[model samples]
Every structure is written in C-alpha cells, then in structure tokens.
Target: MLNRIIQQFGLQVQSINEVEDSHSSTVYKCTLSSGENVFLKIPYTKLKYQRELEAYEILKGRVSIPDMLEYWTGDEDCPGAFLLSELKGKPLTSKGSPTVAFQVGVLQAKMHTIHPPAEKVLNGIRNEYTNWSHFIENQFYSFAKDVEDVLPPQLYKRAIEKFEEMKHQLPPPDGPSFVHMDFRPANIIVDNNKVSGIIDFESVRFGSTEMDFTKLYRDFLCLDTTLYESYREGYNSIRTLIDLEEVLPFYQFTDAFNSIGWCKRRGMEKNALFLEENVSIIKNFIL
Candidate 1:
C-alpha cells in the first residue's frame, strides 16, 4: 500500500521509517529516491482525516504549517493517508531555553488574528459556543462528571461550587479566533531558536485565546518565569494584553480537571495524583 502511494507521488521510495504508531494514527518518515524526506500520516479513522485535511486547506499561507503533498481515502490501491513535506526541525524538548516560548507566543498571536468566514471554517465542538463563559461552565461540569469516580469527592464538590460562582464573574466573551486547541511544545517543531512549524491540527477550531494559552502556562511557566513572561510580552506586541491575573488560575483549574479525567481513563494513577494536587492548589485560591 505504501509503495502504491509513493508511486502516486511520482517518487521512488528509498526507505521508510515508522516514527509513530498509536491507536489513532500511524506516521512514517519516508526517504525518497531523490533523498528528500517526507512524512506520511495514516489516520485510523475517516473523521480524523477530514479534520486534518480541512486544517491544511485553510491554514496554508497564514501559518507555518506543513505543506500537504497528497491526501487519499482508502481504496483498492491505496489506504487512507496524507503526505507532507518534512519540516526541518526537531520536536521541542524541555531542555531548550524559555526564549522559544516568546516565539511561540508571537506565532499564536498571528494565528489568532486570522478570522476566516464562518462558512469557511468547519463546525467544531468547541467553536459552536459564542459565549465563552457558557463553554467553560459546561466543560467544567462535564469534566467533573467524567472524573467523579477518580477524583476525591470533597475536592470535586468544592471545584464545581467555586466554578459556579466564578462563572458569573467571567468577562464578556472575547471575539472568536482561529485557535490551536492543542497548543503544546510537543506539537511544535523548532530550529535555531525559532518555531519552524506547528503540527497536529486535528484539534484546530474557532475559540477563545484562553484555550491555547492554558497549555503554555500550565506546562512552561513552572520551568522558568521568563517562559510565561516572554510569551506574554510577545503576544501583547500583536494583540491586546490578556488579563493573566483573571485567566491563568481559572484555566489552570480547567486544565487540571481535564488532565485528571484523562489520567484516570488511562489508568495513570501517579499523573492523576499530580493533577489532583494542582487541583487542590487551585481550590485554595478560590477559598
């Protein structure tokens, strides 16, 4: 099947390296006859394929996204797959300096400024809500239900009640923007201290900037103060300054709750406990 796909691209396959294999997708790093490298992503489902294809089609010139060469749904000759130009960089590791965070912030700001027509953007679960407060309120409660069994009952009750109070205090909904709903270091490729490309757009949707900023803060801020500060500095240069005082702790609670549920489902007890601890810290803030 791979050989057939390679022929469709008019390339002679020199070798193929399996880079990722998971329940959702299989990815390969392919070396072509001309010694050029390309990446192929074969989604386990058709729905995943469509989401990624829509992203490539819409985000081409506006962002530092990969160049899609070809996309095919499975048939007799070929299986479901999409091929992209291999970006020249490595996935970011925690070892890199915090300066990269500033660059990421700039890229995110640029991405958010892009407002395509509503008709053009695909309908996404997150994007459906015009009211940001409603979205977070619903998500908080929904996630509460999901994590109820694993989360301590007292903490869970406290979180739900506090969120109810906080929801009313939430500011008016921010304007909709193109949001990379899963903005994390793992999804970014860096070279020479600059973000060369952003990948994995399956979670791309129209939503609030808070959705993206949550990850940057939750993951990178603890490593270095400069990471969060520089990111904010870069972002403010393009967009209006975000009220970090208001949004950070609120979104931290949201992310922690979400992570706790995920860890419980995967039977990752230690990670769940870590997130549970963070949830406790957030609960203290509310008190």
Candidate 2:
C-alpha cells in the first residue's frame, strides 16, 4: 500500500506515519526523500473525499486551509485520497491559550463572510428558511425514536414539549453562509499561540453562524471562560456576532442528542452516559 501511494504520487518516500485522532479518514504523514513533508487523507467515504477536495478548492486563498498538492479518485485497487502541504501545528488542547481561541473566532468569522455555494450544502438544521420553529421541531421529531432509545422516556417527552414551546419564540436565522458546522477546538490547529490552519472540511455547509458557536458553548465555554469571551470578542470584530445566549442551548441539545444516538448505535455505553449527562445539563437551559 505504501509502495502504491509512493508510485502514485511519484515520490521517494522516506516514511509514512499514521496520524492519530482521524476517525473518518486514514491520515498519514509522509516524509519524502527530498525531506519535504506532506499529509495524505484517504477518506472512507467517496462523497466526503470529494467534498474535502472541493472545499479546499473554494477556500484555497480565502482561508487558512492547507495547500492541496494532489487529489486522486481511486479505483478498486486503492481508495480516494488527497495530499496537502504539511501544516505546522497541533490540535487545540483543553488549555489552549487565549490567543488561539481568539484567532479561532477571527478565522471562523472570516469563513462566515464567504457566500453560500450555488448548490445547497447538507446542514444539521433543516435548509428551509420560511419557519425556524418548524425547523427545530422537525429536527427533534426526526430524532424522537433515537432520543427515546437512549434516554428515559419521561425525560425525552418533557424535553420535546419544552423544545416545541420554545421553538415558536425563537427568532429566524439571519442568513445562510459558509459555516464550519463542526467548529470545535479539536478541528482547529495552533502553533505558538497562533492559528496555523483549520481542518476537517467534510462538515462545511451553509447555515446560521450561531450553529458554530454551539460548539464553543458545548466544548469550550466551561473549560475556559476566557476562551469563550476572547472568541466572542474576536468574532464581533469582523461581523455582527449572533446572540448565542439566545440560541446556544437549543443547538447544544441537538448536538448532544445526535451524539447519544451515535454512541448508542455503536454500543459505546460510557460515551452515551457522558452525552446523557450533557442532555441533562442542556435541559436546564430550556426549562
């Protein structure tokens, strides 16, 4: 397999080391004989591979995505993959510096400025714009079975009722724009307190910018208040920041519920327990 990749890219391979923490794709760090380095991502799904390639094409100069060196759509003998210029950075950690968090916000705000693509991208929230109430309600309804399967039926029923009532009072999305739907710390890369790049573009879609902040609330806010404040400040510097306080809880509920469903399906009992705890936390915000 290494030989095939080396031959395909016409490179004198020095080493191919598997990258950790890549779930959807088999990622490798390749060091060429010339001492230059590149990263290869072979996606398990063809659609995701194509989306990542297209995302890079669209974001090449505007954002801090890695430079694409080569893209291959594989045959039966191999899998589809792409090579990118090796970026120097580490994933954002729990103790991420304020600068890193601020930069994350700035970068995310910049991405939100990019116009939505001609073709609608898949979004967690329903794409229809006429009614946000219907959107959230419908979204929860679709997950009703999964919610029941993973959570206590009484809690699930009560949560649904609360969500239905609150949905009507929520405001409509301001507009659709390019959003990194999975904009969490892990997806951001930093070096020396500065952001070098953002990875994992398969979840890029046209949606409300508020959706991105849900991750900030779920994954970063409690870990570091400074990160959240700095991020909010930085984002407000570029564009009108969404009032995340108004929408964050609802989005967090959806994310947590979806995670629980995934965990239950995979028989990840511990993971499901953690997510159930999160749901309990989110319920307070709604009720």
Give candidate 1's error at residue 25 in angstroms.
Answer: 4.2
Per-residue CA lDDT of model 1 for 96-146, tens digit only, reads: 566787777778888888664666646432363376676677766676766
Q: lDDT tens string, model 2, 226-269?
A: 87888878888888888887877667767776666556654666
- Whole-model alpha-carbon lDDT for candidate 2: 0.73
Candidate 1 lands at a TM-score of 0.82
Checking candidate 2 for backbone clashes, the offending pairs are none
Stretch of 10 with least lDDT, candidate 2: 122-131
User: What CA RMSD would you report for each candidate?
Assistant: 3.6, 3.5
Any idea how many clashes model 2 has? Answer: 0
Give the best candidate by TM-score. Answer: 2
